[model samples]
Target: MDVLTTQTLSGVQTSIEIAGTVAFALSGVMEAARKKLDAVGVCAVASVAAFGGGTLRDVLLDRRPLFWIEQSWYLWSVLGLCIAAMVLMRAKHFKPTEKSMQWPDALGLGLFAASGTQIALGLQMPALIAVLMGVITATFGGVLRDIVCNEIPTAFHDHHPYAVCAFAGGWVVVVLHYLGFYPNAVVAIGAATVTLLRLAALQFEWRLPTWKIED
Candidate 1:
C-alpha cells in the first residue's frame, strides 16, 4: 500500500470508530431518558456506553494512548449530544418507547465489531480470538450501560442474535482482510453485514434457542 493510501485508510477507520461512539452514546441517552435519570447520571451512563468497550479493548490489546485519549473530541461530542438529549427529554410530551434505541445500538454494534476485528488483525491475533474481541467491542458497552442502569444486559438476555450478528460481521472482516480487500472496504462490508442482520433479526423476531436442563 502506498503511504498516502495507508494514511487515508487510517482516517476512514477513525471515522467509523467515531460514528460507532456516537451511536452508542445516543443509545445510552435514550436508555437514561427511559429510566428518567438526572443530567449527571445520564452523562455518566452515556460516556460509559460510548467508551467502555473501546477502553476495554485497548487495555486488553495493550494499545497505549487509548482511543478516546487520542481522540478527545469523542468525549466532547458525547457531552454535547448528551446535553441536547437531556433538554429534549425535558419536554412534557417527550417519551422514548422501548424500541427507540434499536437502530443506534445495532449500528454501533456493527461498526465496533468490524473496528475490533481490524485492530486485532493488525496485532496478528488468532482469527477466532479476533472475532471474540470484535463481539466484545461491540456489545460490552451496552452491557455496562445496562448494568449501571440496573437492567439486565440485553446482549445476555434478549436472545435476539445480538452477539451473533457481531460475530458474523467480525468474520466477514477477517475474510475480507485475508482476501486482500482494502481496509475501508472490509470495514464497510462487515459493518453493513452486522447492521443488516441485526435489523432483520429484530424485524423477523429471530432468536437463539435457550438452554433448559429441566424436563
Candidate 2:
C-alpha cells in the first residue's frame, strides 16, 4: 500500500473509533441516568462503556500502550462528551428510556466491529481470530456496562441478534479485505451492514430461539 493509502486508512479507522466511543458513551450515560446515578457515577460508567472492550482487545492482542493511552485525546474527548451530555440532559429535562440507548448501542456495535477486525487483520492475525476480536470489541463494553448497572447483558438475554450481528459484520470485513476492497470502503460497508442488520432486527422484532427447560 502507498503511504497515502495507509494514512487514509488510519484516518478512517480513527474516525470510526471516535464515533464508536461517543455512541457507547452516550448509551452509558443513558443507562446511568436510568439508574439515577450521580455525576461521578455517570462519568465512570460512560468511560468504562466507551473503553472497556477496546482495552480488552488490546490486552488480548498484546498491544502495548493500549489504544486509548496511545491516543490520549480520546480520554479528554470522552470526558467532554460526558459533561456536555449531562448538561444537556439536565437543561432539557431529557428523560432517558431503555429504548433510547439501543440506537447508539447498535451504531457502536457496528463501528467497533469493523475497526477491531481491520486492526487485527493489520496485525496478520487469522481471519477467524480477527472476526472474534471484532465481536469482542463490539459487544464486551456493553456487557460491562450492563453488569455495572446491575442488569443482565442485553446481548446475552435480549433474545435478539446482538453479537450475532457483529459476527456477521466481522465476516463482511474479512471478505471485503480479501477481495481487495479499499480499507475505507471495507470499513464503511462492514459497519453499515452490522448497524442496519441490528436496526432491522429491532424494527422487525426478530427473535433468536431461546432455551426451554422442562419444569
Candidate 3:
C-alpha cells in the first residue's frame, strides 16, 4: 500500500481502537461491579481491560510513546466511563451478569482484531504474524482483566471460541485488504465479522474440543 493508503488505514484503526477501548472498559466495569469491587479496583481493572492488549502489541512492534501515552485523553475517557458504568450498575434493580458482557466483549474483540491486523499489515508483517497480533489485541485485555479480578480468564476457560473469533476476523481483514477493498470497508467488514461470529458462538455455545486426560 502507498503512503496515502497507509494513512487512511491508520485513521480507520484509530476509530476502531477507541471503540474497542470503550467496549472492553465496559466489560471490565461490569466484572468489577459483579465482584463487588470498590471504585479504585473498578478503575484499575477497567484500565487494564481497556489497554492491555494494545499496550502489549505496541511493545512487540516497538511503537513509541505507547498508545495511551500518546493519547492521554484515553485514560480520562476510560475513567469517566468506569464511573458512569458503576453508577448504572449500582442500581438496585440492575444486576450485571457475566452473560451481560458477551455483546460488548464481542464488539471489542472484533474491533481490536481488525485494528491490530491492519496495523501489522501496514508494517509489512507476515500474514500469520499479523493475525496472531490481531487475536492478541482482541482477547488479551479480557485475559488480564479476569486475572486481576482473581478469576479464571474467560477467554481461556470458556471454550467459547473467543480468540477464534478474532483469528477468523483477522483473516477477513487480510483477505479484504489484499482484494483491494477500501481501507474503511476492510476494517468494518473485519470487525463486523468478528463481532457476529462471537455472538453466534455465544448463542450456540460453540466450543473447541479439549484434550481429555484419562482419569
Candidate 4:
C-alpha cells in the first residue's frame, strides 16, 4: 500500500474506533444504571465495555501498546461520557432499560466489526481470520460488560443474530477491500450493513435455531 493509502486507512480506522468506543460506553452506562451501580462502578463498566474487545484483538494480533493505551484519550472520553450520561439521565428522571441499551450496542457492534476486519486485513491476515477477529472485536466487549453486570451475555443467549451480524459485516468489509473500494467507503458500508441488519433483526423478532431440550 502507498503511504497515502495507509494514512487514509489509519484515519478511517481511528474514526471508527472512536465512534464504536462511545457507543459501547453508552451501552455500558445504561446497563450500569439499570443495575443501580454508583458513579465509580458506572465508569468502570463503561471502560471495560469500550476497551475490552479491542484489547483482546490487539493481544491476539500482537499489536503494540494496544489501541486504547496508544490513544489514551479514549479512556478519558469514556469516563466523561459515563459521567454526562448519568447526570443527564438523573436530571431527566430517565430509567435505563434493556431496550435502550441495545441501540448503542448494535451500532458499536457494527463499527467494531468493520474496523477490526479492516485492521486484520491490513495486517495481511487470512480472510477467515480477519472475519473472526471482527466478530470477536464486535461481541466480546458486550460479553465482558454483561459478565461484570452479573448477567448472561446477550450474544450467547438472546437467540438473536448478534455476532452473526458482525460476521456478515466482516465479510462485507473483506469483499469490499478485495474489490478495491475506497477504505472509508468500505468501512462505512460495512458498519451500516451490520447495524441495519441488527436493528432489523430486533424489529422483526428474528431468531436463531436453538436446541429444543425438553425439560
Candidate 5:
C-alpha cells in the first residue's frame, strides 16, 4: 500500500487510479439508486460519469486502442463495481448516511486526477495538456453528475478548491518526475496530498468566495 501510494504518475500507478475510478463509479451507482433510477439508467449514469473524461482524453490524444479499450479489465472492473453497487442497493435500501461516503469520494477524485496526469505524461503529452487531463479526470464526472441532478457543477461557484487542489497536486507529481524523482513515489505523494487537502476542506466546511453582483 505504501508503494502504491508513493509512486509518480506512471502506468505503474494506474492500478491505484483504476481502483479509485471503481470507487467513484460505485458512488455514482449509489447516487442513481438513491434517486430510484432503474437498472439501465443507473449503469448508464455511472458509466458516463466515471469514465467520461478519460475516454475523451484518450480519443483527443489519438491514443490508439483507447485507454479502457486496451485494458479490457478496466471496462470490466467498472461493470463489476456497478453490478456490486446495484446488488448492494437491492440487498439493503440504499441511502446516503452522509458519513460513509463523503471522504472516500473526495479521495477518489485526487487519485484519479493524479493518475490521469501520469498517464498523459507517459504518452509524452505536453505539460499543459497533461494537467488538463488531470483536471478532467478529477472533475468532469462530478460535473456530469450535477447536470443529471439538475444542480450547478460544484467547481463553477468555487465551493472549494476541488479542481485547483487536483491540478496543483497533479502538476506536483509531473514536476517531480521531470526533476528526477521516482515517478511512482512522487505520484503517490501528489495524489495523497490532494486527497488530504480536499478532505480537509470538506471536513472544515471551507469554501472560496461567492461573489454576488447586484444592479
Candidate 6:
C-alpha cells in the first residue's frame, strides 16, 4: 500500500495490541472475581493474561529479559487498569462484551500473532516455528487463564473459533510478507483477517470438525 495506508496499518496494529491487553486482563480479573478469588489472585490473573503470551514468545525467541520486564511501563499500565476495574467492579459487577470492550481479545490476538511472527522472521527463525511462536504469543495467556481457573485450555479444544482466529492472523502476516507487503500493512491485514474470521466464526457457529472413530 501507499505511505498513508501503511501508516494507518501501523496505528491499527498498535491500537489492537494495547486494547487486547486491556480486554484480556479485564477478562481474567472479572472471572477471578466471579470465582471469589482473592485480590492477589485477581491481580495475578490479570497481569499474567496481559503479558503471558508475549513473555512466552520472548523466551522461545530467546529475547530477554522479556517484553514486559524490558518495557516496565506495561506493568504499571496493567496495574492501573486492574485498580480501576476493581473499583468499578466492586461498585457493581460488569460483564465484558463486544459492545463495551469492542473485541479487544480478537484485535489483540491478531496483532500479537503478526508482531511475534514479524520479530521471529527478522531473527531468521524458521517460518513454521515463527508462526507457532506467533500463535503462542497471541493466545498462551488465555490458555493460562483457563487452566488457572480450572477450566479446559480454550485453545486446546474445539470449543470456539479462538485458535483459528490467531492462526489465521499469524498466517496472514506470513503470507503478506512473502508477497512483499511491508511490516505495517501486513500486520493490519493479518489483524483484520483474524478478527473478521473470529467474529464470523462465532456468528455462523463455524468450527473445525472433531475426529470421529467408527467402531
- Please estimate how well model 6 matches the true structure, expressed as its whole-model Cα lDDT: 0.78
Candidate with the larger lDDT of 2 and 5: 2
Question: How well does candidate 2 score on lDDT at residue 56?
Answer: 90
Cα miss at 54, model 3 (Å)? 0.8
Best of the two (1, 3) by TM-score: 1
lDDT of 4 by residue, 1-215 (tens): 42344466666556655776788888788788889999999999898888888888989999888877876888889888888888888799765566876776777888888888988998899999999999989988888999999999978997899999999999999999999998778888999999999999999999998788778
Name the top lDDT candidate: 2
Clashing pairs in 3: none
- Model 3 accuracy (lDDT, Cα): 0.84
Q: What TM-score, to 2 decimals, does candidate 5 have?
A: 0.82
Candidate 5: minimum summed lDDT over ten consecutive residues — where? 1-10
TM-scores of the candidates are 0.88, 0.88, 0.86, 0.87, 0.82, 0.88
lDDT of each: 0.84, 0.86, 0.84, 0.85, 0.73, 0.78
lDDT of 3 by residue, 131-175 (tens): 999998888888999999999998888667889989999999999
Worst 10 residues of 1 by lDDT: 1-10
Off by over 4 Å in 4: 1-6, 9-17, 96-102
Instruction: Judge candidate 1 against the unseen true structure and give its global Cα lDDT, from 0 to 1.
Output: 0.84
* Candidate 5 residue lDDT tens string, 98-185: 5776666666777877777877887788898888888887888767866785667766765678888888888887897688766666
The digit string of per-residue lDDT tens for model 2 on 1-215 reads 32343467666556666777888988888889889999998988998889989889999999878878977988899889889989988899875566876776777899889878988888899999999999999989888999999999977987899899999999999999999998888888999999999999999998997789999
Error of model 1, residue 124, in angstroms: 0.6
Name the TM-score of candidate 3.
0.86
